[model samples]
Target: MSQPPPPPPNQPPQGGGFGAPQDPPPGGFGPPTPPAGPPAGPPQQPQPGYGYPQAPPQAPQTPPPAAPAGPPQQPYGYPQGPGAPQGAPQQPPAQPGYGYPGQQPAQPGYGYPGQQPPYGYPQPSTMPMQPQAPQGRRKLNAQAAIIVAAVVAIALIVGGGVMYAKSSDKGDDKDTSAGSGGTEGKNDNEGGEDVGGGGGTEKVPSSTSAKVLFQVPAAEVPKKDVWSVAGSWLTDKVYAKSGVSEVVGYDPDSGKESWTLPLSGLTCAGSPEITKDGVAVVVAEDAKRTKANPYPDCTEVTAFDLDTGKELWTKSVAPGGGEKTAFKEVSITGTTVAAGSGLNGGAAFDISNGKILWQPKVGSCEDVGYAGGEQLVAVRKCGDYGNEKYEVQQLDPKSGTVKWSYKLPDGIDNAKVISTKPVVFGVDSGEITASGATDVFSLDDSGKLRAKITLEDGKYEHDCGVNAVHNCKAIAVGNDKLYVPTKQHEGAKQYSRVNEIVSFSLATGKPTSDRADAGEGYEIFPIRMDGSNVIAYKNGPYDKGSQVVSIDGKSFKETKLLETPATDQVRSAISGMVPKSSEMRYTGGRLFMAEDLISAPYSADEKDYAAIGFGAK
Candidate 1:
């Protein structure tokens, strides 16, 4: 996994796990009151850090005879350059290897421990060391833990699940509609018309400010147990969201429920990218849950028309006439739909028909997962349970042949594919950071390593789930660069913290002074790439509402696109839906946030919405 921190504004801070803070419960849409600090002083220039310049040396000063060279008088314990804080207790290095301060080791030999890897790969430590973490970030760790615990306790006692739902509401939603009208084919909306000058057909409205178009209330849960409803997309004619055992299409502007395609079982996985012809696929179980089998295998793949709510095809593969392969994930590349599973290996199918394109031969190696879009990349696992190895292979979409493969180093517990076209991914070695990955790797077209970006613990924020290889958020790759937001820090205003989105060149793996400020009390997170621009979400403060902004990829200038309402009712409804934890989609002057799962609410008065839509007229 490769992602970052907790909530902003009303939400509690995140818990510290793996050096970086893990995701915490949802908080207020506005920032909480920070602790009071010392008296104000003259503002200092920003110090150089990774992807930024190095700090200049102070002029040689004449100290009093016998005076000690005390630490610099900076307040927040944030060290600027190479030197650690003066007089601070010295801490020993955790791992000693190729990457050390001023150590120029020999070129790495790309070989695994016992054999020639499918593709030779150097040891993980050959990567560069991340910049020293700020002590200020360290201090937040303890506070975040305390805040998260308190928030959780309050949720359990008060019986307000939505309040604590901020912490773990990562599940999808169930089917049901309220106050929606209209049916399929009645609307006049047409197909793709890429507006807003980007990759998708997202139109930029004249006014950035927005109003709630409509909302879908949470459906009653069966047996009061959580169920996955994890899929959402925006086509020209419809805004579709997955529900319990069904997929619903709604008019994008009017929020009218147009049509519904019911399913036999729950939707477990969904293709993030829809075809240019308005088609997408989702993985569902073959049968409904029963008393004898509360859990059903996710074995069915269904492709449907996003515009018309028409099912194009539904297919499943039972390898060797054995049990049906239970797939955990699915992705799309061109006309091919790929699904992977650690248990049954992986298989590909034609998007147009239910015909099988290819299926893996029985072997020790299993296709654990895949990341697909401009290309198809599979994450394959081999060896025994305790001692496993992983390989990232770029596969031909139609043929399912490996074009290039890169073997990950030993001791890597997990990895997530960040981008397919540029072949970028993140690796977690446990020794570095616990929250997903500590380093990101970019590969050249030949599958050779290009550059590695070290996400210093607690410095950058992302949400790459522990298991899903393609389920990553708050991170974007475009223009041959990676864009990630920095952890929140003391803002220019009193008792306020802010964060900014920074870019790293994939070619050089260096920070390029490219930063987009999130402003006071606001944190900006990259959602995805639009054309050459970065579509970002800005979490707002108590009185202000969250916003969607378009960041110029080159100039780093921000264009505000959509702003939600700031009223108490609307803010509370929007507060719990963070971009990383929830299924959030924005395009054509509209933004929709849907829950990944749904369950019974704690109290009668509490409102638990399955999805909410907002638009800027």
Candidate 2:
């Protein structure tokens, strides 16, 4: 009988095994803190490793120093990354490659006998040595572990799971609406104050200190930002990508014009996120690149004044970063600014002056994230694909040493740090792009599991888009309430179903009060917690009728936020799902929502998109 052959190098399994690593839970957050990081760029299956034919060891000389006087010379017999520059004697798949450090080297093959091929590549010779790893005392065996990780990264890059995960660093842990429940005390509304309902097209007020508006033309704005970050609020202005490789800030109060920082040729890796005082952007120093260089030829990252376009400092990836692939996610908190990419693990820099702080020693193809706050970065290290264990570590943003780590509980999807303060951890049971369940744990920064918010059926499911948590993982910690989503199919029309937002009290881990149901056909998602309210809405491209609904923490009153719709491009981007520019956002006590649904700019003559801003009336 004929049998099937092995998969291509660095390829996912032939079966249905790949899944989104960081899909969020209901309301985007839920019971029990599950480790959360940045969004897993594109879900990929960990590839299978192969082996090389073994060769007899000649003799072991005192292994060379970590940093050889020059690049360590590859012995005439040893194979290296990319297989000895092609056409070299190919190692056969006779024995398993080596694994685990401090172990004897296999009989000079690709790996220990039976070891999977490194990163699923045809038994490449040796794993590329990490430039930053210690040289003097480290043993040759140490490279074995790193070699395995590098192989996994290669698998990730080829598999298309680019970005990994990151956590939001909103401060403080006070819970105002602590206790309340539902019919069984699951939806208690004890915290609802005396605020009356603002429904029926009543105009919602805008703050004098801030406002929201879209930049002209859809082609100009950045494609997206970090999770939940349509735009950033720093100082008195809200900043976002407006033009091609340009960032613009507007006053949050009156929607007045502010400063615009333009990068002629460089591309914004992703939308900029705020640091303590400045906004950080990861862009290429040179727009043009080639195989010798790479896309984002230079991952030159810069920090700029939130109020002015002045440059604060600049930093680039370390030397020897093979591709120096452009960074995709950047974060700034306290005095540290860190960027992550498959090219560089996690590079943390000093915000005061662009100085390299530290970096992780991983392949130039795996995703890493600044997953926690209080100066913490998160990274996920996976073994072979057949094995379902993922090792997650929290590292000091300043020093790349592991402060702590744990094996993600088995039988769950990938896990990453989602929130640093109040340290909420999240785990996915399915892919975010489709339907799945997210289990959240409330753990301290030290990795202690404090609480778990279990749902009615222990999962959040529906017709999820790319990220299941799109509207399911909303955490209202300030109000001591956690919000989750569920769809009730009461009518025949697909739009006739109502998406329910169930609020739970942090004090009891149960529903706090009455669940708020979006009008039929509308799927209301909580964008963020606005002080005493949860800002919820259904943004749809070309669905001119979506509304922003604010549910008060104390009164549980539903206030329909009011705003002006600007342009079709902005409308298309702010449709809530697959936002092209992250146009509609909420920050600094204000909620920004596009009032109209339209198409992307298809014609030469198109109106710039518009949105409405609502705040305390």
Candidate 3:
């Protein structure tokens, strides 16, 4: 590039110039002077083409009006353009379009007229500013709705799974056919074919194989009428008794007497019990003696051989006799015999050879009994003045070794032990109230309690006396049912009426029947599983003598069997009597009942009664 030329000297070299003054004074040149007034003449006329009138020369003007204040102007330098005033001095151009000092630069893309270029290059014209969409509110709403729907679906699936699990846990598909008709096991016919549409090919259950082969005619006792009948399965013989103290044996098949053994100085009072081995008879006798010498007046238990009426052994437990005992209750099993007495403590005897096995240390006992299978069970009440309490003990039947013992509640006046297959059921009486209470306890083989069912007198309110056996009555266990006879109070006369029969489910322990209602002055004993039909016996509604009535155990409907004529003598003596097994004996597959009938003579009113038997056909 070519360099520019230097300025002239009169201009003071371009930008450094202070040019010479335009005009000067004429004097010594020390300073300029003003011109005198135009020569006194007519005003100078204007020239034709000059455009302005000229001043007439008088003297030179001083110093060109004394230059304006500030630095002198330079020639060939920057000119004061339109932005600057006409005669004013010019300032330096603001450093190539920069603003004044301390002023901020114009923002990029938006600046004053002539500024340097911005830093970033220009962008493409086709690129839009992109209007910054509103973040798609509709899409966000849709996403939120999807999350909520998924959560609800998961909740519903989990709830359905939980319900299905609960239903499956209950085992709803289990077969319930065994519980039908309140019976257990299967039903079949005799010809090995499924009977009653049961699935099995075997017609009948093996348990029904042994049907009733035959039944003998009912036997009648002589002289005093029949009081009770005891049968021996081992000898196929039946023992019958009347008012007399002798046991008369009859053939079960012929209904004829085989032998009559006289009981010397002893009278039968309670039922006889047979040993589990079916070899002996346990006969209870009440001696003829007064309470002053009640020890000698106590009861005696005699064991006799089943084949011959020969007495094998005798255990005399008399009140105040040596031990001052009064035998109240007696029960015998395979290897043991339990006897409860008034004074002498309850004792166990060896059934093989009549010998005292063991005696518990307790007061005089009232009712003593035994239950359970191989493990012998003994239950008894001790104490006098009706303040009796019960004790349950498990012992070895062969050696009389006490395995365990449990003390019952203080109020229990009486107790009975019931031995079903897997458990021992204890039905006990509460304290000496007028009606008393019944408590049922289920015990394991180890003498531990499993469950309890307590029946209070106030809850059931039976009108029986405190000592009545029918207050809570007896419990009989059958195939699938438990029959409990409960005495409900009808009126003021206590212990004089037949009350109710309550059947409870043996499996579930729930009441199965409506309370069975009985008439006034009647007595009932519900018995089931006697070969074919379930039966119950009812006595009385009699004005004088005893009247006998029977009912179907399953239906609770009544069936009249026999009715004896009424007599005033019998009415004054006997209160009531019901049929019962003499010795837990069954003949020809029929449960033998011992009937205690009052022998009322026409001339004298007597308190004596006879025992007899009625064979169910």
Q: Judged by lDDT, which candidate is best?
A: 1
User: Residue 444 deviation, candidate 2, in Å?
Assistant: 3.3
Candidate 2 per-residue lDDT, tens place, 47-116, comes to 2221222231233355522433643332212334442234422222233111101112223222332322
Candidate 1 RMSD to the real structure: 14.6
Model 2 TM-score on a 0 to 1 scale: 0.54
The TM-score of candidate 1 is 0.72
Which candidate has the top score in TM-score? 1
TM-score of each: 0.72, 0.54, 0.46
**Cα deviation of 213 in candidate 2 (Å)?**
4.7
lDDT of 1 at 523: 81
lDDT by residue for model 1 (235-345), tens: 556778887789999777666688889887888778887776778899987778777765677888999988789999899887767567777688888889999764447
If ranked by TM-score, best first, what sequence of candidates would result? Answer: 1, 2, 3
49, model 1: CA deviation in Å? 16
